[model samples]
Target: MKISIITVCYNSATTIEKTILSVASQTYVNIEYIIVDGNSKDNTLEILKKHENKISKWISEPDKGLYDAMNKGVAMATGDLIGILNSDDTFHSNTVIEDIVNFHKKNDIEASVGNIVQHRENGKIVRLYSSKYWTPEKLTIGFMPPHPSIFFKAALFNKFGNYDLGFKIGADYELITRFFLRNKIVWEYSGITTTAMLVGGLSSSGTSSYKLITKEIQKALAMNGIAFSSFKIKMRFFWKIIGFLKK
Candidate 1:
């Protein structure tokens, strides 16, 4: 299977090399690496050019933001499956892609998910995010599956549609919500830690950003026809606090 992995970044000169090398080093040979740059001002472009041969296709231009660049890459991809790897994240191991492909082909599922661990720049793992046997019924309560650790059958985008550009922070949540709730998309967890994410993202910034994200997630729930008015998303926030202690 030709799996397309996309990395979207703005100014990732310091860490883009690790992301590039991780994807390039995947044991799965039939892989396509695409990088969508947001017209970086730093030496990120230089780094991308240095490893241009490993990349199947790439584009550098100003985009609306992260989700916009992700959508662009999805449109440009010509693979059977698609997955997005953040510029700040890397694979958990060399065989992660190979494992995902084997699981998908064996189980015959449309989508697959894996675990992720959040870490500091010094390589300290802080939190672990895992969806242990998630189902569509559970998603109505506002629980989200691991986005970066998910690989989707590319054809599903044509069936359900792409991420909603209206959402600034919760587009990934919204897209998965639409897929599992309104559509009959089959998905399974691969029981592996596929991604190691660096901490300090938009959601982890501070209280103001967290509140904005909660509001956007609420909007997404509504847009996806999930009647979660009574569901307290604040509980999800508390769940993160619990993860720091438990995981």
Candidate 2:
């Protein structure tokens, strides 16, 4: 099946080249790479221009935020399967997309989820986020499948709807909660790490940002008819500290 990968970026000149190269180097030939930039005032657009041949489609304009750019990219996607890779992230290997394709073909499912390794500039592994043992209810504890490792069937958007721009940093969490908990979509999981997300992205930027995301996650859980309290939201810090210690 044809797969479309979307990269939403803003002023990511320092790292977006690696992200584009990762998608362009995918072993899977039927891949459509699309990028939505938020009118960056940096060399990001220049680098995109340099690799324009590999990009199926791209646009540069002001956006509300990250998820807004993602929604725009999703609207432009025309492939059977859709995945989002952030500008600060790269596929763990060239076979990442190939694995994603085979996972769906082998199982009669519309979506596939994998694992992620968060790393630093020296390539030191930080935390390994797995897609294993993920239940919709586990979301109550603030555990989520790695966003970069998820590949969804294009039609899931039509059925379950797109990311809620209403969420600032928790759209992915909210979307997963809605998909698995509220809508009950069929999906498969793999143990392989599909993406290497660079540190200092949206959610991990700072303590304040992390707290905002936790609050949003709590709100998202309640919006999806799951009972969650602010205490459960605070529990995220405990889990996050544990993850950091394990690294």
Candidate 3:
């Protein structure tokens, strides 16, 4: 099965090469790697040019935001399965994509979710984010499958729609809630560590950002007509703490 991996970046000069090399080193050959750059003013473009052969396609242009770039990548994707790997992150192993393909070879899963290991820039392991306990019902509390570890059937975007531009920080949460609960899309747990995510990304800033995302999460659920409260959204942090403590 053909898979498309998208990496959205902006001035990620310090880390994007590792991200590119990780995708280039994948064991699965039938992969399309697309990158959407936000007109990076750094050496990021130079790096992209340096590894031009390894990348299937790339565009360095100003975009609305991360989700906008991701939507562009999705529009350009022709693979059967579509995934997003951030510029600051890398695949957990070369076989990550191969394992996803093997899992889906047996069935036509609409979305495949897996695990991720978030770590510091120093390569110190932070915690393992697993989809083993995730359920569609958890959307009521703002829990979602790890975004980087998710691979959706390309058709899901055609049917359900792309990331909602209306959101600033909760589009992925909104999309997952819409897919799993609103549309009842068929999904599975791949039991594979898909991405080694860096600790600080779009959704992992500071306390103020946390509060902002929590409010956005509430807005996302309400927009989908899913019943949720601020308390439930706050409960998500408690679960995150538990996740961090779980080795």
lDDT of 2 at 4: 94
lDDT tens readout by residue for model 3, 1-247 = 8999999999999999999999999999999999999999999999999999999999999999988999999999999999999999999999999999998887668999999999998999988889998898888887888999998999999998999999898899889988999889998888999999989877779998888888888888888898876786787888777866994
Over 28-108, each residue of candidate 1 has an lDDT whose tens digit, in order, gives 999989999999999999999999998899999999988899999999999999999999899999999999989988997
Q: Model 2 Cα displacement at 112 (Å)? A: 1.4
Local distance difference test values of all predictions, in order: 0.86, 0.89, 0.91
Measured on C-alpha atoms, candidate 1 has an lDDT of: 0.86
Q: Which stretches of candidate 2 lie over 4 Å from their true place?
A: 239-247
Segments of candidate 1 deviating more than 4 angstroms: 239-247
- Tell me how far candidate 1 lies from the true structure as C-alpha RMSD in angstroms: 1.9
Q: Put down candidate 2 lDDT per residue, 62-171, tens digits, no spaces.
A: 99999999999999999999998999889999999898888888898877888999999988998888877676677888888888888999999988889998998999
212 in model 1: Cα distance from truth in Å?
1.1
Point to the candidate with the largest TM-score. Answer: 3
Ranking by lDDT: 3, 2, 1
